[model samples]
Target: MPAMSRSTEAIVRIDSAAKTVFAYLDDHRHLGAHMSASSWMMLGSKMDYEFDAGEARLVGSKFGFHGKILGIAMAAEQVVAIRTSPRLKVWETIGAPNLWVIGRYRMGFEIVPETRWSRLRVFIEYDLPKAAPARWLGLIFANAYARWCTGRMAKDAARYFETAGGQAVPSIG
Candidate 1:
């Protein structure tokens, strides 16, 4: 089957400046913390990060995650596509990603500065897997996984800013 495009987004207000949040999320290791640890969402698997092209900060940079689940290897390579900094940055998967559900995807985040805080929007636009089992699983779980992915990014940012070493929350607006 041909891959189909789908998207999921999560919006949350962080009690911090747009630049601050942008800098934090610009680091893949920081924004992708959820995937690095063992969690129910990952089915007891943890993926390690591989960075290239100036540590994956500039456009055309490549980075990936590699791990295993039940002895089955999984990997996804992504390249930075659009990066404007302090406001918007987008990256898309390259080649056919070997994973459990959704396949190729473009994921990014936007930060809108407010008076005393920032509104953050994390998003993932994905395609159904083309391989067996995962393709079928994509039909049933792609959206759910996308939601979890984006939501985790947003929630992590909020938590970062709400805790020590971050700005105090005045209000989420």
Candidate 2:
């Protein structure tokens, strides 16, 4: 099947420094903390495994979501690759062998420094395969869902920074 791509982005101003925001994003475990509760329900359970990738975090990590369907086990895997600069952090996702939902995914966070805050621009792109009906459904809803999720994540992050005194909190689940 041919592959189709969809992307979405959301921006939010965080009352923190770019370094602090990047630090929060660098940790793979902190990912679920930024997502909405409904999103977490659809994802079922989250499992994360991270390995040392030398200079950067999340460069060689694997995030898995597992759920049950009709008494059968279902799982999805996202292998991560990260590139980091002073102001930009990019996370690229390559579909694992067992998971065929999305072909490729990339999420980038650009932290623009402001006078007393930082503007975080979150960009996410994913490729959907056209071979299966499920993939078609993903294509239809992926963009909107991604946008909603990203917006929620950005807002949650901002709120966390605001209430937690910009401290890096541990990942949830």
Candidate 3:
């Protein structure tokens, strides 16, 4: 059996500059503050960078996922040549010793510049396991969860920017 792939996307218009939005998105510590409660819960605790490289060299920066049921982790990189704007791609890695055997997961955020506000488009792709029970269950729930999380993250990001005067607040916990 072959691996199954699933993807979902969400877009939100934020009342902030594209560079500001991109800066906020680039910081791993501020991720939870801009993510919905459920999304944060699913993503687990605040992420800590495993590599000392700065945001400019995000391609190799690894962050701990820290989820309860799923010990998934993520690596940051650039998106495939799609748009000219700044895009950040975060994909799951199965290098953790105690992590669950979930399939490949990738999430991309494309920040498009606008006149006064910026458009943040988020995309999530999941490659489900090929096995029996996990496949069926993932097909039924993972897709929906991913979509929900994507949308919620976009919305929360907008709200965060709006409330914080277009600045990213430091992550709590």
Candidate 4:
């Protein structure tokens, strides 16, 4: 986040309350669902997660994703920078990231109240990877990855609430 020069954002109107949506997404264990699973966006690569102490449920907490991509190891550590209850949550990558495409980033989600539902905005401000190969590839795929990552988060939340049917959101450890 120190010098993130590019960003991508996606907004979706969810059929759930501001509080409801915030509560759901605030538990970021459920966020980044797309990256934890193999998909076209990830080119069939799946990353494993590790959340430390209280599962990164509050500011100053840490979490990460580590996995091999095309026979090379890649990883990143992220720390929650801000968490305003039932409204906004932001996290940023720490140290150098050994990954492809988008590298270090500040990612966040915000919920806005409406009469009956909520408007959710998911965004990422990022810098391309510093490694030459990854930076070169990033110039081609960074925006696409950002768009897909944000869009997927929004879509995932929407689907979650719809199928949840007002039941309580579950905890993931």
Identify the candidate with maximal TM-score. 4
| Candidate 3 RMSD computed on C-alpha atoms after optimal superposition onto the true structure | 5.5
Q: Which structure among the candidates has the greatest lDDT? A: 1
Candidate 3: which pairs clash?
A: none
Please report how far candidate 3 places residue 162 from its true position, in Å.
Answer: 1.0
Worst ten-residue run, lDDT, model 3?
A: 74-83
Ranking of predictions according to TM-score: 4, 1, 2, 3
How close is every model to the real structure, measured as TM-score? 0.92, 0.72, 0.67, 0.94
Q: Candidate 3, after superposition: displacement of residue 101 in Å?
A: 10
Local distance difference test, per candidate? 0.87, 0.62, 0.58, 0.86
- Report the C-alpha lDDT of model 3 over 55-87, residue by residue, as the tens digit: 323555444433233454533222222223355
How many backbone clashes are present in model 3? 0
lDDT, candidate 2, 1-173, per-residue tens: 12236778899999888888877876644545533133452454433343344323645555545544334454555554555644776656445322234445677678898999999887777776446755875667666667865786677778879898877555634
List of clashing residue pairs for candidate 2: none
TM-score (C-alpha, index-matched) for candidate 4: 0.94
Q: Cα lDDT for residue 27, model 4?
A: 71
Model 2 root mean square deviation, Cα atoms: 4.3
Model 1 scores a TM of 0.92
Compared with the true structure, the alpha-carbon lDDT of candidate 1 equals: 0.87
Estimate, for each residue in 78-123, the C-alpha lDDT of model 4 and write its tens digit: 9999998788899999998888898889999998888888889999
* Lowest summed lDDT window (length 10), candidate 1: 164-173
lDDT of 1 at 114: 91
